[model samples]
Target: MRCRIPETTLREALAAGATYAAIARAHGDDPAAVRARCVALDLSRSRTQGRIPPEPVLRVALAMDGVSVARLARAWGCHPDALSRAARRLGLPTDPVGRAALRGGR
Candidate 1:
């Protein structure tokens, strides 16, 4: 069965600083779908408002051998995807295990 999220809940969640993924999980929907809906409804978060780790710290973390993105993100108190994005922006190698984890493989 398809999950139907109420518009009021979406608005309230957005106002309470919940991310699209968070809203999606709470309402049993796909994050990408929620993000698209938010964009269509003009309820998405600001582009510059998310967490970004410091370059030096990210560089050090990326340099560590055999470290997964999820572990590093937890250590840095940020989301894995956010850390991964930061690593990509800094041209760092995201370990294969970490990439697999991101895809829910491990």
Candidate 2:
């Protein structure tokens, strides 16, 4: 037997920026079913809607000392690959240990 998701719970999850797959997992339903329901209800927010903006991420990368791209990506709720690309494009260092060493520390 399949579990039925309540409309209110679905709406609340979407409003809280939960992805379809996440919502489906929490509700014990299929991701496709959650996506279709969201579409029908006009409640879907883009996957990137609540994520940190790229420009600010770049700024943080440049301003922070000894921060790795992977660490920043985790903190900013984005992919490490995306942070690495942004750091490269912005001419910022991507390795934490190397950056620290360059700054005259471990």
- lDDT scores of the candidates, listed in order: 0.72, 0.68
lDDT of 2 by residue, 1-106 (tens): 3336887999888778788889988878999888877777787665332254466556555456756666666777777776667667766566655455545523
Candidate 1, which ten residues in sequence have the lowest lDDT sum? 97-106
Kindly list the per-residue Cα lDDT of model 1 for residues 43-106, writing each as its tens digit: 7776435456788777666666667778877776667888778888876668766544544523
Candidate 1 off by > 4 Å: 1-8, 17-36, 45-49, 74-82, 96-106
Q: What's the true lDDT of residue 53 in model 1?
A: 71
TM-score of 2: 0.47
lDDT score, candidate 2: 0.68
Q: Of the candidates shown, which would achieve the greatest TM-score relative to the real structure?
A: 2
In model 1, which residue pairs have backbone atoms overlapping below 3 Å?
none
Residue 21, model 2: lDDT of 89
- TM-score, prediction 1: 0.46
TM-score versus the correct structure, for each prediction: 0.46, 0.47
